[model samples]
Target: MKSQLFTIAIAAFVASLSYARSYANEAKSEQRMNVLFLASDDLNSWLLGDTNRYAGKVVAPNLTKLAESGVNFKRAYTAAPVCSPSRTAFFSGVAPWTSGHYHNTPGANSSEPLKSALSMAGFFKKAGYSTAGYGKITHGWDQGEHWDEKIGHKRDPAPPGAPLTPSGRGEQDWGPIHLAEEEMNDTLNVDNAIHRLQQEHDKPFFIACGTFNPHMPWYVPQKYFDMFPLDEVTTPELREDDLDDVPEWGVELTLGKQKYVDSVFEHGLHKEGVQAYLATTAYADAQLGRVLDALDKSPYRDNTVVVFLTDHGFHLAEKHHWQKATLWEEATHTLMMIRAPGVTPAGGAACERFVSLLDIYPTLAELCGLEPPDYLDGRSLVPLLRNPEAEWQSTAITGLTSKGGPTWHPYLSIRSETGRYIRYVDGQEEFYDTSKDPHEWTNSIGDPEYASVIKRMRAAIPSPSDAATPLPEVLKNTRE
Candidate 1:
């Protein structure tokens, strides 16, 4: 009888231990914060902060409100200027030079470091959170497999008689479509986010909603276009002789898009294009506003951490270029806002420290009480979030990879608080004192006064040897 009692006691003790562990895990998950990750494609700093280039031109009340509610990094930059590479670099927590995956067509699927690194959603899912993603989180590769629930991105439907602009590049056109707000793809993503917020989640959640508007072929409802009258739209400041002082590669970057610029001038569609872009941006903001509204109404509002950013900035005729892929300020400088409920200062704070999208992985990991993998190249921005005026000793590095000849060329730029230094693959250099020349029209690499500044910036750039991985087979034939 005693032996049978002893066996029953052992079984009970083992079950009790298992229950204790499960209870502890449940409590830990409850204590942790939920994350709401929001992203916009090809969004610039125009509507975000006090120091943006276009101060009052944009009609983005939602973006302004969100910026007012969080720590807005005024100097936030992308890892790369292009969509695919920038998204990959930030999502993988690896630098572009390290991955050697730069273009949209060929991605970093083959990069060993990227393949091993835990994606943002993957990390949260591993930490027992229910992860769901919608819209353009990972650009070319949607990364649907990484999330427990995913709704792949869909582009806004093209209105009848599309190509509002008559450029040969059809996707470059922009105008308003006739679809209802509920019919837009971004609206669908926002609706998904709203529905997720409304659901009763058993565990902490990581929800990502990405908006694809304001990227290209910018089409929204007619009401958005009506918001920005074509006559009232002002084009970005342009220097007619901007290319005079640029390096050969830099000039080539502009010349490559000369056809688009010529088309704009040829058809007198400059102001029209600007109006379309602003309208599309406003449309994106509206979707974000809906998501924010749902969150505000949901039970998880106070406990959820919200992060909003863009994959990269777009160049609307700045630097004499019409698109991204150039390592210039216009293409790299973007908007990044984070609101950690109890941690961030109420009513928003502006962080002027130079930060990169690459820092997001570690920052979210630390914010949610998860241990970050040591392989991440970015440091946690939790300190900056807690204290916006914190002293930061880092500069944001943005790069672009283009094949100039037989080998790929990595164009790199280091952006500091006071200046910017760019180094092309062929050893050509350009340095600008951004504090004095915000437009970066003058290249002062040969100037003797800034020799030490250029030297330090040059030393910070990753060596060509560090870019060991070659572009995937998709990009072998043509230059990006």
Candidate 2:
């Protein structure tokens, strides 16, 4: 009895000492980072030198400057093809399959949002940081009431083209614009974001400014449209038989339910649509410059951690499809850039490891010295940022669920460092190799040469499926 009492007394003393030590450290670490999260619409890694900065592509000068001062994640991917799920994953630190959100929608899914305070805005609030979101916060909603404060912006001033509202071909009267700038519907999101950032706040904050240029309704100001003339632009090449070598599942996805002005695609939209997308992208990049400008002038500039990404990717008649919603590189692959006070490497170093957007939470936690909840699906990326050349896990997964219309393709695909695997619900499949076919033109589903490869990728689907809507039937027939 005497020994027990002695032990209890000593334990109490140690606990008190530990608490004091923690308190002391917390005081010193109070200099936490302010987060400046820049989310652009439909942006992709290919545009930002995430993997390789192509010689012919337009360089994002501001983004390049950011890379010079931070690390760029080359193989990073979004959780879903559209905006909502991707943003949800980042805010919630969870994947779409688990969150019951795989499309760009406004409300809660059957499951809680990936991050549960209903949104990431709430997460920051609980951590004692002021949270503000501008631009596209939820897919359709402006900043939510959940944020400590919310503001919004919209791109263009005109009504959506005729195609979207009345008849599918109604917008043909507006002449033509590329895919990106056409979505400039309204709200002056950039200006609102800047205004919100300039407002005084009681604590360090999480400021998310989304740029809409690259989403859809890809219409840009006349000034930016003139910057890239159709004559000087060369269409990114496509092989006439690009789909021949690809698996049926892969080819099937590239074909979908997109309509052009007056049903003109069968006649011709490749020229009018594709080049406009390129131009619109250039304009979007310019808007990004605006947000960065705001950050450069803000009081929190020195202490902020800036992370940028797109919801997913777009398909401009790539597989013969004009909209988003697929598991291919053009749909799942994305751009992610992060610059923190003392953590990111300089000179635009590239991290080739496959990382999911869900990693954003833990990575920010590491940089800010905060504790992350235990249920997150992504691991911290601090190590990868520090050493971009280090070894990492081989594959990154992406999910897709249709919003509406015919669902003919696979919903889940696992992209390895060098290959891709598409699995359908009814046992169909598609596969590709990055080394031999960067555009995923060839389908080798039943090819004997790739049987072992198929076997390996097939083994990767998570033991317990995270999504209920399995891959579609047409996609399955393409599998080996």
Candidate 3:
């Protein structure tokens, strides 16, 4: 009888030990580094330190502060220059070319590879982290199910008469709305983020806060407008014949949005438009400052990996364009900064490598010790983070979705440290030696002196079979 009791006690003790091991595993996961992903809408590189073209012309104090504490990617470019495709490329770890989602019509969640692939939020949730997203993370939060908690964003309220600037298309105008800063939509979004940061989490968290200012209808409080005087606003450098040397395909993209610029100039809203964008950007920066302050005060400050980036760059009459969707520097060059505690440098660092938003997925995965999917198109930027001057050889590729149907073919832009090379489907090309012609006023495609460079860039274009995924038959007409 004593021997039988002894055997039962041993079995109970062994089971307890196994349970303890399981508990320890859970605790380990809870101790992992947290992630604070911040995104801004329609922001350009004008405010990026050491890479700012509009130095002292834009007021983005919070963005400047964030860059001072993290690694600022001076030459970051978007995978696609449009909103839906750009966001989809980063969050889905799939490029627009692969997904065949070149436009904003068909939701990315409905697309194939994006539909099946594990998203950035999903990957974190699977790795035992609590994922929460506020504001515009994915295009309309199409993959909303991945988050343990999620909140969608809304635009700033319009004034009584609306369309304050009296130019441009739907939600294209910009001015100060007669509202308090706290009453703004972005402030409310940041409120949710601050609340999440204050709460106690049993496990590490992945929090994404996105602000939608500096986008269309750039509505913010009157105080933000007061900060940027209209007379002091600096307009982008422009040439009367900027497009005279551009290829037919490039000209087509510009003409589509030319009406907006024409209307602005006709109505004399040029300075007001520039002022509104800067004011709206400053307002967005203020909202971001709130979240950053909250993080600094919270316990997660020491361990959280904070990343700030915009979906894509906006064109403020640069290249005679008013908005995104072009493959030019004004449309594709964006702001990207990462602050990984103990991983990135103390004060800050600037990396000049040609990186893309597509790299964010793998970089975050590797930083958090999570396994990235095999199908990711971007390489991890860990080495660059460790040493800002690391030897890296990579180019950023931006694709413009083609108009659908039998003759549909996507346009490709390859950006390297040397220059930018754009290739259209008809074999027409445009090459800009950005080193000498920053405004890209001259197209060097006809110059025989750069023939070898053109050939090398042309070879980098993906093959026809691997290029664009054909848009689904049903959705092609909806957009094109």
Candidate 4:
């Protein structure tokens, strides 16, 4: 009887140990954070502002709500003001000046040095997370292999509506579509993301949802157009001689695209174009709301990190320019907000310090307690995340190659908290005191008082040797 009782006691002890071990493993799994990366194409920072000039004119309630819940980098700028290069900088943690990928057609493989480098998705996948992406994430380059599961790029069909302008400028045209919202490409992408969020997964997942709205050919339901009536639409503040004080190179860049703006005004489509942009922006916001709602309902909601940013800013006849590719404030500034479950405080906070999109990779790695690649050019934004008012010493850098110009001829711009400085390869320069001239209407490069400021900003640009190699023979002839 005594022997049998001792054996039963030993058996019970072993069973208790097994149960404790199982619970430990489960807790470890639960602690691993999931990542949800959201991206939009050609979204201007002006549209996201509530106190700026365009405030209350655009409707994006979901985005506004998200900003309230996270930390919004109010002055976040892109590494490059173009789609492919900006996205590339975020993924590879390499700046355009370092990779020479100034256009929208180059891929990670295009740069020999980055061929084997792991993208953000690839990094998470290697670390045992299930990674997936949908819509326009990598420009025209195919990053399908980098993701464990990916939805191929989808092109939106021309909406069955009349052209707003007579130019009928292919993808640049905008009109109201006559189809259901469910048929929209952006809506379909959101649906795909929602389905993935609802599925049960044994491992943490990294899901990327990219929306192509307000990009071009802004086609959405007529109801969206109705949101902004023609009479109520407000154009951005424009100066008739905005480019007069600018340098020759700067003036040339503005004049080259003045024709597009001329066409819009000539056809009396300026108000209509602005209306289309606001409407498409609203449509994108609705899709974002759907994804956010799905996540809130999912079990992983408490452990997930959400990041939303635009590839780059868009120009709607601002600074006499109609599109992106210029180094001006309108084209370089973008929207960036991050929501970390426990690290970020509940109430939305704004960080006014200068930050580049290149910091996204290192920021994620630091948040997850993972080691980032040694080649990352951007410093981690973890410090700013922890304390928005912390003293930061970094500057935002942006680069652009002239449209249809030689690859070696690139312009680099650097922005600090107080001023913006631009220098072309040909020795031309532009300087703006952001505090005094927010619209960058006046050039202060020649002012003696700003000589010290210009000297400091000029020192921030990368040396010629640090810039990316020229495009290959096959890609050199490609136009924007």
TM-scores of the candidates are 0.89, 0.80, 0.89, 0.89
> Hey, what RMSD does candidate 2 come out at?
8.7
TM-score of 2: 0.80
* Poorest 10 consecutive residues by lDDT, candidate 3: 471-480
- Listed per model in order, the count of residue pairs whose N, CA or C atoms clash below 3 Å is 0, 32, 0, 0
lDDT of 4 by residue, 1-480 (tens): 999999998997799578546634653555567899998889898765642335338889988888888889888899888888889889877677776667764444566545545688887887778988987777644446668778855767886555655844768788778679999889999999999999998988899998989788888998999999888888788888887887777777777678888888888887888888899999998998899989989998878889999988888887778878889888899999999887777786988888999999988876665667776778788778767888889589998776644445678899887689999868889999888888888899899999988998988787544444443321232211
lDDT by residue (tens digit), candidate 1, 53-121: 654389878777888888988989998888888998888787777666666645567554465567788
Clash number for candidate 3: 0
Expressed as tens digits, the lDDT of each residue in 229-263 for candidate 2 is 76665444455666566445545555554344225
lDDT (Cα atoms) of all candidates against the true structure: 0.81, 0.64, 0.81, 0.80
Query: How well does candidate 2 score on lDDT at residue 279?
Result: 63
If both were scored by TM-score, which would come out higher, candidate 1 or candidate 4?
1
**Top lDDT hit:** 3
Error of model 3, residue 127, in angstroms: 0.5
Ranking by lDDT: 3, 1, 4, 2
Sort every candidate by TM-score, greatest first: 1, 3, 4, 2
